[model samples]
Target: MIPEPDPALARSLADDLAAAGYTGARLRALWGVAADEAIGRGRALPARREAAATDSAVAILARLFFLGSPVRESEASAALTNVTIDGAERLGLVRMSSGSVTPSVMIRPQAYVDEHGAGEWWIASDIDESVRPGPLPEDHVLGVGGASLTLAGLQLPTSAARVLDLGSGCGIQSLRARRDSPDVTATDISEAALRFTRLNAQLNAVDGIRTLRGSLFDPVQGEVFDRIVSNPPFVITPRGADVPAYEYRDGGLTGDALVCHIVMGAGVHLVPGGIAQLLGNWEYVDGEDGLHRVRDWIAASPVPLDAWVIERDRMDPIAYAELWIRDGGTVPGTDEFETMLAAWLDDFEARGVREVGFGYILLRRRTEGSPALLRFERVEGAIGPNAALGMHLAESLRAHDRQARLSDAELAEAVLLVAGDVTEARHYLPGAEDPSVIELRQGGGFGRTLAVDPALAALVGASDGDLPVGRLIAAIAELLEVDPDALLSDLLPRVRGLLDDGFLTFAGGEASPSA
Candidate 1:
């Protein structure tokens, strides 16, 4: 078991790291760019060689902690000026014997940019595959990975009364949430994971984070939060003695049941107007669509919720089995890999699961009346895992609420502006004066593209802040020789879609002329 965290030692370590210039950019400069990138791919030899060449405090510390390599006790003692080797050992950061100090945990600098601006935090978590090079123990705590950064980037940037970070592994989401909310509660089933959360909070000098030990929402029953962010242990795994369920990814549930449990329980713990953002997976059973299944989950919520779910990728059962089997450090040709693959396939076959869909889920408990938004879309594109999309999401939600309240006639009278990130592209045939296809492309926020007809494209092009929607359509109708009512009827619903997708926005007021 990991030792309980000590705040004084964490503070000292933080100061020593800061003084040593131990930052992501600085470390990347210490090693070449290729070596830094190689470390991310679990090949640390290049970085190890680079660290061996330098005797600086940062290099010595990196060798001991970041690379999980043994270091001479004298060098470690000299490197860690504030938190000495004894303090580090007591804090469960390292173990010392025979004039050598070996790392028990890794403290790496993580850099992030969000709506609150850019900053760096030192994240301390258990040693990863890069250092350990084997199948992880079931209780292994995870450091920052792709999924962690995804949920962290997806967290709403707006202020909140309180936030709950369910399944906070290395406390990355908790740290990110604390930037906006004054209070954050990070919960995990493993006590060791909670200790890391507490230690990381102290190391980063970020307060107002309370760590609890429990599975799912057991630690926060009957309590309501303004926001909830989670990258949960939603990985589907077979239930048997032969199969290993890593606590970091698998929630010990069958075939996306864990995601369902969290979705159903979220509505109960969210305050009215509260939002819950989480990454999840859902199984497509036999012929049932996965997105529709998620829609049903929202419909079955005790408290009606506004839901927006985007399925980013889908994998067949075979692909899914291989992906997770390899994630457990099993090579493709190995006997254990084949056994686990067979077990995973058998489980999927038993459940009639044909495919699994992975995506982002945003749920909002309604403040009053029934839910208004229920969008489940399969977005296809290469979106950056750590893109700062919270600002776009918040703006889109506000636009949705505004347009949802407006009647068609009222919306027609509202002045609108095409978003700055939106662009128009026209494709013409050879020797043709008129374009055959007109596409409106979004530079951000899902990077959506829409093909528009000439009338709609003309209306969009003419949507300056000076004129209201009704007038713009009228002018376009005059130029195109179409009936004004016919054009308005054709354009109103598309305008609403543009608003919801953030292609356009109200100039200032919901139904007022732009000033």
Candidate 2:
């Protein structure tokens, strides 16, 4: 079990870590980039080999905290001047036995960048599969992983009065949310997880994050926040199969019911116009689409909500079963692995589950009558490198609200500028003077590609902020010999779409999307 966090010790440890230059980038350079990447996939031998020849303070800390290897007591004492090796043991960060210090928890540097800026935090959590020789304990507290980082990046960069970090495993999301909001409430069912959240917050010297121990919304009942961000334990696991239900990924409930509960119950705790962003998994039953099921969940809400759900990935039942089984430290071709796979398959068959969809969900409580935004789509392709969806989502939400209030004539009178990241791609048949296909591609923000006709292409190419949209449409219609009114009627809605998707923006609002 992790010890209760003492603020004085945490501050000392933070100071020592900073002095030793313990950061993600520095560790990656110490080992080759390939070895660093390998550690993320639960293979630590490469990094272990690379660290064997080094005895620097950073290298020693990397071996103990990152690779989960024991370090000599003398070396650790020399490195941790402020925290001291004795204080570290007292804080339950390590165990000293036979002149060696064995790390009971892992503290590694996490680097992040957002609209505000770039910074690093030292995150502490339970030791991982590299150190444990067998299956993970059912109540393990996980460190920062790919899913955690994805949800962290998805958080909107706007400021808020209060924010909720549901299922705050290691307080990564809490730390990220604290960047925008002054007050953050982090809740989890596991006490160990909540302890890590408190420890992490104090370690980073970030204040105003309070921890509560309860399941889902129970701890935050009757409270309304401006934003709620969660990477919930929504992984579908079978019940009564004797399968290990890890607390970090499994929500104890069967199938996707936990996510359903979240969607159906979010409205009562959200103020009008409040937004909640989360990552979840939904099941696609026999001949039924998962997105449609999510739509149904939204419809069942006691209060109306605006939803924009994106399904980033999907996998069949067998593949999903194998993927999760391997995650619990079970090797393929082992008897235990086969047993667990069979249990998962049997459970899925009972529900008529055909596939599972994983993705991001953004929901907003409608301040007034009826919802305005209802977008459900699949963006399963690769996006541009370092895409900043948080900024894009915030901008798109504003654009949607702006366009919804405007009449067709008012929109046409507004000056517009094409986004800087957009480019035109034309395809032609051999020996043809005119192009057969025209496509506008977005380099960021969902990486959308739209096919356009000659008139639309000409209008976009000429959107240089000098003319009103109406005038540009009139000029393009004249060039194409089409009726001006007819062109306006056809392009008005499409232009609205472009504005909503960040392809085009109102003249003075043309800030480039972040990398």
Candidate 3:
């Protein structure tokens, strides 16, 4: 009988690997020798008997190495399995139902940290050569990738007793949360992903990262979280098809279905006053507003929430369709590639999707009667500290709420002073002198320049929070010698826009949205 492998033996191998300069390519070479030895003898190799052998093997593979390469798998089976194929099967070293040993079944490695090193080692899926490969292994660990780190850093810093990392692929976000929060629960649809998360947590020296296997929100029923973070599969897939094996990229939904569903359901899972922050994409319909769609979803929600939605970037349908197709490794000239691309465009067009917009969404639960703030604005770049633009928005929301209870005269008395650091400028025509243009420019914080009509400019100048807006407009009309009706008609919209953009603020209580 083959001896059971010792976990310590794996650690020794990893140490030797570090000493031997075992880059990924060199590790594969060593793995081939090991596999050849086992296959040539046609028998199951005994479990590692000596620390030296394990060390020697690991010294050649290194901690940064991933052992799932096909060449390495072949080598591992040949070196580690018994010469007698049947003996290998009896030991659970290889599945014997198939006449020949399959690398997937026969070549399994026990990942471990190098004895002298600090980071953890993990086993991952062997790169698949198949067209439509099976889902990732139940314990399939992953290499560090950009998106994983992005989500980790983007999470809001809050100490919560309980936190949830939904769609926790490779467990990177979960690990970060566990480091910051007292308790963390991670969930994913793939069993392999869950297993990988567990292994990764252990590797990273993080304990208490609970792993659950289920779709988003399904695994955490009846549980409320102080903070919930997700980097879910937001890519809208074609209809009637299972997405590729990369669970990290595919949400298994068609045309913004996943985003809408998640946003609509998130409120139910959050504790009163809890925050839900997520990265998502929405399809922009030709006639319907994208912001309005998200607003409608939140409005239909059974729970009350204050929401902030920012559209960071948008791509035309054709460009969006082709981007994901290429990401899936579809070659443009191939027939299969053409079919997939065509399908994506057809579906998008059928749904009236003209553009795909990506953004960050933040929602907070509020008390009854709190007005929900739904904002849709175009941002210049990626979401990060550079996008710290949202910080002022929180203050703005509070100000608006305070402004709501004031009387019309009190509102009129509210003087609109430009924020500190804002400068007012007047631009004159080159030759013909009509009314000079009045512009307000701000150097920072939601940078914008607005062209103020002469009447509105005079009213804004006169506003000292003493008179109501209606009387102020009337006074400004009298002073400017213009028709009050025409001035009000032209200036009302401009004033509202300025308020919305944070250029102007009411003097007294906070400013609320106009009905």
The candidate scoring highest on lDDT is 2
TM-score of 1: 0.97
Candidate 3 scores a C-alpha RMSD against the true structure in Å of: 11.9
Q: Whose TM-score is higher: candidate 2's or candidate 3's? A: 2
What TM-score does each of the candidates earn?
0.97, 0.97, 0.59
lDDT of 3 by residue, 92-188 (tens): 2234333334333212232222112223234333232121243343233344444554555456544567889988876767766665577899998
RMSD per model, one decimal: 2.4, 2.3, 11.9
Model 3 spans > 4 angstroms off: 1-147, 241-246, 369-371, 382-515
Return the candidate ranking by lDDT, descending.
2, 1, 3
Candidate 1 lDDT by residue in tens digits, 1-515? 56998999999999889988888888888888999899988899999999999899999888877888999988998889898888998999999889999999999999999876789999999898888877778888889998898888888788888999999988999999999999999999988889899999999999999988999999999999999999999888999976798988999887788899889999999988899999999999999999999998888889889999999999999999898877777778888888998999999999999999999999999877532888889999887555447877887888888888889999999999988988999999999999999999988888899999998888777777889999999999999998999999999999999998989988975532100
